[model samples]
Every structure is written in structure tokens, then in C-alpha cells.
Target: MRLRAITGFFFVIVMLGSVLLGNVVFTLFYLALSVFCLHEFNGLVKQGTADPNLYTGLLNGIFVFLAFAAQSYFPSKFLLFLLPVLLGSIFIQELYKKSEHPFNNIAYCFLGLLFTITPFTFFHGMAFISGSFNFHIPLSFLLMLWANDTGAYVVGSQLGRVKLFPRHSPKKTWEGFIGGILITAGVAVILSRYYTEYDWKQWVSVGILISTFGTMGDLIESMFKRSINVKDSGGILPGHGGLLDRFDGLLLAAPIVYAYLYFITNA
Candidate 1:
């Protein structure tokens, strides 16, 4: 528990500090993390396999960085052009390599990078938006996820009698799941009053959805880990596991919440 808390604190401090610095700094940090995460992800895929020497991990890292930079700086048309170009390039490369499972590793690596980095584009977008509200959007994103996770832990520990999904995650319970939503919604209302222009009703709605779906994201990653018969994604952090283990919920929650913010708000 102490180790987890320490690691969590370090993550929060570094993340908030980078965001406060500016978009460019934040983008650089995110780009570096995206590469690291993609490497870890591909390593997982290639472990104990015949295709361990594949360069799909390196290529996927490059693709993620390029995609993020394009999405942030270039026009949508450029993005459209880049996609097919990248796909054809990867396909041709795989064909030339001709491993036993030539396409499988590359396809999965590319998809993993996409899944990991796209949502983070929203954080970069948030930092670019004009506002004098001290720019709490990034903090709010992390806070909401934290509230949901912590609330689920405390509440579930106290009153988790009914299993939520024993097959996916035996430790999860329906009561704890609802507890996470309520806590996240409560935090959202508070954030709405201070930083955001959103109404309490909308905040609550978004909060509940984010929390529920975030839990599902955690479960989905857990399912992947279970299928692969691994204990944790990696042991990079002290007690928090890997990037996947820590940010599993955000993989799903970030995109959903970003879409809600984009469509629901006039900003």
C-alpha cells in the first residue's frame, strides 16, 4: 500500500507538472511515454513466441508519435493521407519479413499504439483551448479517474457482497462499482462549479458514464491479462504494475469524456 501510494504520487506530480508547463512540453512527454508503452505492449505480445525479433514495436512507436503530431498540428486531410500511407507501408514491410505470423504482431502492435495514444490527444487539445480558469481540465481528468478508483476500493472493501464479474475480475463487486460512480459524479459536480462551464446535471451524467465505462476498461485489460496468463502488465513501477495496469480505465474513459466535452459544450 505504501509503495502504491508513493508511485501514484510521483505519477500525479509529473503529469500535472508537465501539463502546466505547456502543450509542447506535454506533447513531448506524452510522445516519449507512448513509445515506452508501445514497446512494453509489443514485448508482451512477443513473449515466448517465435517472432520475438520483429521490429513492429519500433515501427508502431514511430507511427504513434507521427499520428499524435499530425493530429495535433496538421489538417484533417493530412491525417487521412497519412493513414493509408502508413498502413500500406506497414503491410509491405510485413510481407517482406514473412514471419510465421507476419501480420499478427504488426497489426496488434499498431492497434495497441492507437488505443493508447489517441485519447491523450484530447489532453493536448484541452491545454490549447482558451480560458482563464487556471486550466484544470487536465487535472480534472486525472482526478475523476482517481476518485472512481479509490471510491471503488474503499466502498468495495466495506460492502462488496455481490460479484460484478467473477470471470473478468473476481475482486470487483456491483456495490463497489456503484460507489465509484457516485463518488466520481460528486467530484464532477464540484469541478463544474469551479473550473468548467458545465452544469451539475451534465457533469453528473458524464461522471456516471465515465466511471461505469472506466471500470469496464479496467476489466477489459484484466481480461487480456488473464487470457495471456500473466500476473501484471509489467513491473516498471513499485506497486502500481505497468502503464497498462495504471491507465487501463483512461484508455476507454478519455475518449468518451473527450467526445462528451466536445459535443456537449459550445467551447
Candidate 2:
């Protein structure tokens, strides 16, 4: 427990610092994070018999993220053209690399991008959600997600009786699920006071989405880990597991919440 708390504390500090420092740090930090997580993900995929194209996949991940990051910093159409070249390079390279289950390799390569790159691209796009880089939206989103996670764990450990998803994660409970939502909603209320871009109601709605989808994201990752017969994604975080384990919630939550913000902002 002490180790977990220590890890969690530094994790929170670094995450918060990355956002608060400025866009340069934010971009660098998350870009490094995306690559690290994808690397970990690749390791997980390779444990099976198929080998994913690490370099090409990493290139694609880098390109995809930089493409969006560039747009956030400065708009350009020329950067958009690089997508096909990078993505197509995966297939082209795969054609020459002789390996058993070649198609499986190709599939996992793209899956890695879909799994890591896409959502992260959307997350980076969040800073520009208001047509400029303001950390409030991204920072608020993380806070709410963390709040939900902490709330669920505390409540689940103590008051949990009924299983929420016994198939994937046995320890999860309905009481904890609701507890998370309530805690997230409370955080949203606090966020409302500072981030007036959206009122209390919208923040609360975002909280709900984070708690709901975030939990689903956790279970989905659990399902993936179980299918592979792995315990944690990696040992990067002491008590947590890996970057994947820590940010699994962001996998699903980031994209959905970004869409929600986009829709409302445009609507």
C-alpha cells in the first residue's frame, strides 16, 4: 500500500506538472508517454507467436500524433498528406518481412495504432478544443477520471458486496461504480467553479461519461489482459502495473469525452 501510494503521488505530480508547465512540456511528455505505452503494448502482442512491426508502427504513431499536434499549434494541409505514406509503409514493409502469420502481424500493427495512436491523437487535440491551447479541459478531464478511479477503489474495497463485472474484474462492484460516478460528479461541481466554458451541468455530464466509459475501458483492458493470460500491462509503475494499466481509462474516455466536447462546442 505504501508503495502504491508513493507511486500514485509521483504519477499525479508528473501528470499535473506536464499539463501545467506549458504546451511544449505537455506535447513532449504525452508524446513520450504514447510511445512508451505503445512499446509496452507491442511487447504484450509479441508474447503470442506474431511479431508486430515495431518501427513502422512507432513511425505511424509519431506521425499521427504530430499531425494533430501540428494542427493544434498551427494549421496546415501539407502535413495531412503524410498519413497515407506512413500508414501505407506498414503494409509495404510487411510484404517483404517473411514471418509466419504475416497477416496477423499486419493486423496487430494497425491495432496498435488504433489502440494507442488514435486515442492519444484525440487527447492531444483536447488542448485546442476551444480553438487554442488551454489546459483546463485536458486537466479537468484527467482530474475527473482520477477522481472516479480513486472513489471507486475506496468505496469498492470497503462497501463493495455485489459484483459489477464478475467475468472480467471480479472486485468491481455496483456500489463502487455508483460511488465513482458520485465522486466524479462532485469533482465536476468543483471544476465548474473554475472552468466556466461549460457550466456545472456539462461538467457533471462529462464526469458521468468519464466514470461510465472509464470503467468500461478498465474492464476492456482487463479482458484483453485476461485473454493474453497476463496480469499487468507492464511494471513501469510500481503498484499500478504499466503505462497501459494506468491510462487504460483514458483509452476510451479521452476519445468519447473529446467528441462530447467537440459536439457541444460546435453545436
Candidate 3:
């Protein structure tokens, strides 16, 4: 328990620092995170008897992320051209290898890029919503996520009785899930006062989305681990499993929240 708390404390610091520091740190931090996440995803898929092309997949993922980050500087059509070429390379490279399930490998490689890399790219989009490097969006998103996790754990431990999803994650409870949403909503209320980009209602809505979808994200990763028959994703983070385990919620929630914010602001 002590070890987990210690690891979490430092993890929060690093995450906050990366976002608060500047655009360079934020971009580089998430870029490195996307790479590690792809690495872990490939490792897990390999355990399931599929040999994904790790190098090609990593290169593709990196390129996709860089494409998103550099879209402002480069032509928007550049990614439309670049991604197909990069994805084609995966198939071309697979021909050289002697794997029985060639298409399976290709599918997993694309899955890694879609599941991990794509969502993180949206995080960069969220930061640039104001046409600048404003840290409010990203920072508040993290805070709400943390609040949900903390609230779910605390409330679930004390009052949880019914299971949320016994198959993928038996430890989760409906009580905990509701508790998390409520707590996150409260945090959103506070965030609106300081970060005035959106109203209090909108912030609360973001919190609700993060709590609900973030739980789904966690469960989906648990499903992946269960299918692979692994306890943790990797040993990269002590007491926290791996980078995948740490950021599983962000994996799915980031893109959804970004879309919601984009539509709301534009509408």
C-alpha cells in the first residue's frame, strides 16, 4: 500500500509537470508514452500467439502522432498522404517474414495504432483547442480522471456490494462507479472557477464523460489482460503494472472527450 501511494504521488507530479511545463514537454511526454504503450500492446498480443510487426507498428504510430502534432505547420492533407504510405509499409514488411497468421499480425499492428496511438494524438488536440498552449484543458482532464479513480476506490471499498463487471473486472462495483461520477462532477465544479474556457455545466459534463468512459477504458484493458492471461501489462511501473495500466482510462476517454469538446465549442 505504501509503495503504491509513493509511486502514485510521483506519477502525478510528473504528469502535472509535463503538462504545466510547456508544449515541448507535453508533446514529448505523450509521444514517449504512446511509444511505450504500443510496445506493451505488442507484447500482450504476442503472448496471445500473434506476432505483430513491432518495429513497423512503432514507426507507424510515431509517424501518426507526429503528423497530428505537426498538422498546423504542415499541410492537413500531408497525413492523408503519409498514413496510407506508412500503413502500406506494414503489409510490405510482413511479406518478408514467415508468419502463419500474416493478416492477424497486420490487424494487431493496426489495432495498436488505433487503440493506443490515436487516442493520445487527440490529447494534443485538446491542448491546442484555444489556438495556443493553454494547459487548463489537459490539466483539468487529468484532475477529473484522478478524482474518479480515487472516488471509485474509496467508495467501492467502503460501500460496494454489487459487481460492476464481474467478467472483466470483478473488483469494480456499481456503487463505486456512481461514487466516482459524483466526485468527478464536484471536482469539475471547482475547475470551472479557475479555468474559464467553459462554463461550470460543461466542466461537470466533461467530468461525467471522463468518469463513465474512463471506467469503460479500464475494463477494456482488463479484458485485454484477461484474454492474454497476464496479471499486469508490464513491470515498468512498480505497484502500478505498466504504462498501459496507468493510462488505460486515458486511452479511450481522451478521444471521446476531445470530440465532445470540439463539437460543443464549434456548435
What is the C-alpha local distance difference test score of each model? 0.73, 0.91, 0.92
Candidate 2, residues 15-68, lDDT tens digits: the string is 999899988889988888898888998999988767988888888888888887
Please give the ranking of all candidate structures by lDDT, highest first, separated by commas. Answer: 3, 2, 1
Give residue 21's error in model 3 in angstroms.
0.7
Candidate 3 residue spans exceeding 4 A from truth: 72-75
Judged by whole-model lDDT over C-alpha atoms, candidate 3 comes out at: 0.92
Q: State which candidate, 1 or 3, has the greater TM-score.
A: 3
lDDT of 3 by residue, 84-182 (tens): 888899999989999889999999999999989998999888998756778999999999999999999999999999999999999999999999999
**Model 1 pairs in collision:** none
TM-score of 3: 0.97
TM-score of each: 0.88, 0.97, 0.97
Candidate 3 residue pairs in clash (backbone atoms < 3 Å) = none
Q: What TM-score does candidate 2 reach? A: 0.97
lDDT of 1 by residue, 139-230 (tens): 77778888999999999999999999999899999999999999999999998898656678877877786798789889988987887778
What's the lDDT of the predicted structure labeled candidate 2? 0.91
